[model samples]
Target: MKRPNIVWISTHDINPDLGCYSGVWPGAEYAVTPHLDRLADDGARFDAAFASAPVCAPARSAIMTGCFPTAIGTMHMRTKAVPPPEVRLLPEYFRAAGYYTTNNVFTDFQVEIPPTVFDDCSPDAHWRNRPDADQPFFAAFHGMATHESQLYLGEEAFAAATAHVPAGARHDPAAAPVPPYYPDTAVFRDAIARYADLIAEMDHWVGGILAELEEDGLAEDTIVVFWSDHGRGMPRAKRWACEAGLREPLIVRWPGRIAPGTVVTDLVHTMDLAPTMLAAAGLPMPSHMHGVPLFDAEGTLAQAPNQYTYAGRDRMDEAEDTSRTVRDPRFRYIRNYHPDRSAMQHTQYPDHLATWSELRRLHSEEAKELAQGLRPDLLTPLQRSLVAASRPAEELYDLAADPHETRNLAGDPGHAADLARLRQTLQTWQGRYGDLGLRPEAEILEGWRPGGRAHTTAPPAVVRSPEGLAADCPTLGSSIAWTTDPPAEEQREPSPLERTAGIPVADGRRWHLYTGPVRADASAAWFRAFRLGFEPSPEVAVNIAQGVDDAQ
Candidate 1:
């Protein structure tokens, strides 16, 4: 069988509250989303699909490379480096396997704008209309219309839905399942309702794209994989290791190839998608990819005694912390690098913030007490004084017992054995991946620096002229003109990381710091990171720099 066209439809922060996942909406149960619903009815739906990281950048990195976020050092957002070149990304693999690859202008690889993931990554008709009609295609798309920045529509939709209630009606705390730690307030309900609206809108877009695929006669030849980068935009959703943050809706459809109406409850991670696609295409899986194909020709997953999935949260919003989690079918284990941080620390609790603001504005008499009681900045519902101090360093959760993960079981005596086993698994993974987890206190005490480089206090300056090999350096006062193309190397010497480093900064002003390597193409983030004196992630940087432009 020849390889089929692949269409990967990815969305931004969204939760599993759709009609398919949650029966809350009208007609959701009998919703006629012929494209997506048909896919689910025809192919397998993974109940346990999860993102490797809860945030966008790292999650995308893991999805693309079939490697954990930490494995590539792309833990944080825009600040962290991109993946080094040479390692084949999922799209690149498809491209090499004789497929025309396209991406719809969304590159969230923790770098600057203009993603560098593909050969034709433009948002124009170019990607929508692949010239290579004879070859099978791979088109990956992401939508930001439902993201936090575009949250107004959801808010408006929610207010309209609740218009029947009197403006001054008191909120019924009993109506909703109050988070053990939070006060059941109207604000919370409002937020959840608004989030649902956003999700509804997102689904509409998903349906639209799938509809277009069908209209263009691409659906039949395509294997449609729909998923989100992470969960929704709420506290404990986007930046945490909890199920709400990591678990994503995954629907895979490959007509006649995958079994119809199958639901895989086995533990699966984001990295697994890449190898699975390669296997489906009859292409040899790269040795570096850590994940396995999800199914065989018989349309069944490989049997195993236990399955493991992992997730990590490095940094998001304002708070920067490190955490890793391991989840089996039965339990979820968390290893927090900085346990002292608040469980909800960098997370933006929109409802809490808005409520705190409203109470102070409307009820001034009680405002002082409420403000005094609550940690104004912490966003926790509790008014405890001591709890605001710092977060703990480690935590464990009995996922079966507490699905919401409201209680921490790390300090419990009864769970010691379970904790130890999970810790061992974590250590084994760390060793296998050569993880550079937070350095030990002793190493820091001994004045250790990553990469063994000292912080230099010198501004960047070009010593060599734009043209290569001048006997003399440019005069200090002379102005250097910018050039479009940097000098091409007939035989470029590989950097330490086997990367090509030089790029034209301005006018033939070739600057080379250290970019890890060249991958699909170099991004602008590569230039900036290299300029910052750290090695640039060639693939990510290039993607960010060039964006989804077809020429890039």
Candidate 2:
């Protein structure tokens, strides 16, 4: 059987608000995503897809590695944690299986992806750039047009954009429906409308990519999978484990394989996509991957419906908290390890939005109202609890009865048995995954630090050896690499400096990889060093002026 080419198009902070999910959201009729709607019409639409982690880096890490972020020590947001060397990433497996893998620009994965994972991984990386026309390819395109920051363009710009809104594409903020927890203020409504506009923009980009596939005549042979990194970029959505945060829109278009307009209601996690793609390519799933393949070789659903899907939240931006959630079809359970912390923790990113400011202002006013011997009905009990100094350790909600998850049933005697069952399930999952959430934040940070500070490779000290210039990092076991040109900054675009031949030292090797010292005739050289789980060292230049004996 031939392996189908795969194109994974992922977007940021979007949930299943598309027309095909149900109906166009009120006031978001202008979010006419005809292309995505058409794709859903022609392929499989997963209604219960969720992200394993709420934040970008951790969720992306889970998706790329097919393992829970916690299992790989990548659960914390933006904290660089290197997985054990033995763990292989999804693209690496696909590449090993003869697939030309490329990641178009953004790789916000929490861990460093070794160079071997991709054939090309630059801003211009694409399946169209593959050297061989017949080679099976795996490409990922990440769209950021719908990111939360785009909604922060200020009121004047938003009004101008809304006024000029393309013909029938004008979303009225006054008619937008706000979340139950949020006050129906102009700021909140405008934010929702702007978000819808961005989603429409993101859809346009998706259409262009699909058109390219058709133009290349690779549409039929390629499997197109579209999804978002997590949920909508709102206060309670992006970093929380509510359905708004964890649930995502997933559409798979595998022409001639998956029947048109098929809807799968089975629970699926984002991490599962990695293993599913591997299975589609006829490769075995590695044992290290925690995700299960959803489809068999025949392009039919092979797995039984999952009883529950899990999601987690930890250390988003400057806020530090640990929360775990378990969601079944009917019930959603949340366990907050840091119950003393308010749900409205000071996260710098979300605080930039007008809606966030409105929420804070409303909370303050509600507090004042209560002090004056009167309670304002503007805030719901759940909303009040969110801004409180402490929170319930455990919360249980029945989605069938209260879809908004406003009521907590954890303490209800009638739901005690249901709560216990879900609680046990969450605990078992935590144990199975070796959840690092239970560990103290300081301990986790200390583990990533070397010599009582954050682990950063120091530049190798260049000394005038008897032979010539010798470079070595005294920090023991640091991997050293040196070249005539400087290395690229870590996590940025690959520099032309990378094209030059360089010496590399293997991890755990005490000595530098270069066996012999540089000769006097050599030009000035640049050197750097890095260890797994740590930041790379600053570039150090060794000038071989005049002769080796006179080198500074």
Candidate 3:
């Protein structure tokens, strides 16, 4: 059997809000994403796909390492966390398996990932740059097609992004549904409709990516996986530990392997993409990875009987919050460590959005009127709870009965048994993985960046030996990378793809993942070491005697 090429497409700040996911969740029916819908019809769409965290950096970190962010100390948003010493990203493993890896490229993993993990890693990187047609490839393309920034508070920005969409393709704000937490207003409805519009734009972008596969005549020989980092970029839906924040749309297209029109409802995390790729490539699953493969031996698209998926949230931007959640087939249980903080803790980042701005203004006006006795409890329970002084320590929601999670049944005696079961499950899961978020930020920060500053990894000492040139760094568990015949500078090309027809050779100057010594006799070799939460070490130049003799 021949190995198949792999193409991964990741979107930003999206959720199960496409036409293919219409029946999976509420408010999803409003999208007009024909490209993704057809892709799902041709391959498989997973209804229970989820992220390990609700934010981009943490969720992306989890997917990269095939481990939950909380377990690997990468749970906080926008903050780099040091992963375990043995952790190698999926691409590095793929490279070791003799696969030409590429990333075109978004590297917000919240951990230091060496550039050598991929042969080409830039906005223009592509599998077409590989050595030959026979060589298997792993190409990943990530972009902000439907990201939160697309909301476009400024009219000029909105017009520039949505100008491509036809009048019929645009969504109707009047028909948008309002969740219980968000007040029914024009602003909320417009935000929902705009999200659907962005989904349409994302579908167009996805079509272009898929067209590339078809254009290269590799669509039938490649496995394409599509998923988003997290959920929609809305108030209480993005950074919170709710169902909307964690659930995502996952579709896999494996020609001749997976059956068409298969809808998988079993729980699968975004982190599982790594193990599935390994299984597809006939590579051994790393013992430290926490994900379960989604494919059986016969390519039946069946999983290893997973009952629940988990997620965590911590230190979102300017606000400090911590929560862990466990979701079964039917219910969701969230345990908030800092119940003293309100669900809407005034995070400065989201406050700038149109939806968030409107929601805050309404909450403020209502609070002012209530405080002066102008209105008596006029706010709905769901709305009031979101703006409460403090959140409940525990929250339980039956997803089937309340898809929107508008009701919390934690204290209800009728649901106490299930709540207790899920709470215990979360505890056991956290303990088993040694949840690093359990420690206060102060203690954890001391280890990552002491004195609120990033440390630098020591330069690797490269020594010539009988085998080759071996490089070792004094910094514990630092990753090392090297390249020969390097490019003149580090800058992107004007085109989206920078491919050379010539085949790759031993001393091509392309970066290599430094697992051991370099046996290839090359001109000049540049080496660097990097670790998460630390500054990358300065480049160490080692000139071979055969070429330049400028060794340092």
Candidate 4:
């Protein structure tokens, strides 16, 4: 069998809101996503795809490494945590199989990519840049135009910008449907419309890449995958583990293999993409990955569909909370570790959205207005209740009956058996994964950075080898470098008379980037090591008393 090329195009902060998945919600007939719709038409669209984490970095980490964010200690947002040295990233496995792998411009991966992982990882990185035209390639292109930060523009400015939206795709703010939890004000409605507009913009970029593949005559031999990092960036979404936060739009186009217009309802996680790609490349799946391949070699759904999909959320920006969710086709169960923290806690990112601001204002004034026998514009009592209510320790929702997750079924007497089953499932998963969320935040941070300080790597140790002095770093995965001179020591003279005495120093200009053993002409040398996101190792001097050759 011939190896197929892989192109993964991932977007940010989008759910299954495209016209193909189901028309855009709340009366908007369709979102402008012709290119994405075409991709769905040309291949399979997964209606039950979900992300393991609600936020970007952690979720991307899960997708790239095929491991749960909690298991890998990357569930916290924007936290730097690398997988153990033994683990290999998705692209690294492809590179080892003689495929050219590239990640274009966006790798907000929680873990650092080892030096050998990619052929190129810059803005210009692309499959076309592969040294051999016939070589199989795996490339990831990230589109960020639809990110939630884009929606932070104030309502007036956002509305003004919508004028540039394609005339055929434009949506009116007045007619836009607001989620039940949000106040139905023009500000909130316009924000939702603007998000749809951003999705359209993301589709434009996807079209460009698809066109490139077709023009290059590689579309037939390539497997193209499109998905989002997580759900829309809004209140009760993004950082929350509800369906609106974890569910994603997943479409895979594998020409001549996957049947066109095929729709898969089997539960699939974002992490499954990596394993699926490895399977397509005919590489053995590593044992460390938590995800299973979604499709068999013959392009059919793999046997024994997953019984439950899981998602987790922890420490999103300034707001700190820990929650885990397990969902089956019909039911979704959430366990909040910190139920005391209100679901509406002031998270930095969501608080800036126009809809969030409007909701807060309405909720605070609703009581006063009702006392005066007045009603706010389109603000329902239920919506205000959502804003004021605190999260429960356990939340159970019958997704089949209430897709919005508005009703809490945990307290319902009739669903006791269902709740117990899902709770046991979540507990078993947590135990098996050694979920760090069970630990205190301070403890987790301490584990990441020993002694509660930025990890300071030890200076490279120098030893004699056949060639010369070989430098080895004590900290695994850190880059090593050697300088003839130790960093300039701070001169603190006890007395002015001692200032004239010369401090022995080697030539600083002789610094060299360390790859392996290098023949050193000098008997003594200085070495240092550093890794991204960690403190630099202190410079140390090594004395070769027996000379480099004799020491060997």
Which candidate should be chosen as best, given TM-score against the real structure?
Answer: 3
Candidate 1 has an lDDT of 0.57
Question: What is the Cα-based TM-score of model 2?
Answer: 0.82
How many clashes show up per model? Answer: 25, 0, 1, 0
Each model's TM-score, in the order given?
0.69, 0.82, 0.91, 0.82
Q: How close is candidate 3 to the true structure, as a TM-score?
A: 0.91
Which pairs of residues collide in candidate 2? none
Worst 10 residues of 4 by lDDT: 497-506
lDDT of 4 at 26: 33
Candidate 1 regions with alpha-carbon error over 4 angstroms:
23-35, 80-86, 111-117, 125-128, 152-182, 296-300, 304-306, 346-387, 437-552
Q: All candidates: CA RMSD in angstroms?
A: 10.9, 7.6, 4.7, 8.1
Worst 10 residues of 3 by lDDT: 496-505
Q: Name the best candidate (by lDDT).
A: 3
Candidate 4 ranges beyond 4 A from true positions: 23-29, 154-165, 370-378, 452-552
Candidate 2 Cα errors over 4 Å, as ranges: 23-31, 155-165, 452-552
Between candidates 2 and 3, which one is better according to TM-score? 3
**How well is each residue in 5-67 modelled by candidate 2, as lDDT tens digits?**
999999999888787786422222446688899999999999889999887888988898888
Residue 362 in candidate 2 has what lDDT? Answer: 84
The local lDDT score (0 to 100) that residue 181 gets in candidate 1 is 40
Whose lDDT is higher: candidate 3's or candidate 4's? 3
For model 3 the local lDDT of residue 494 reads 28
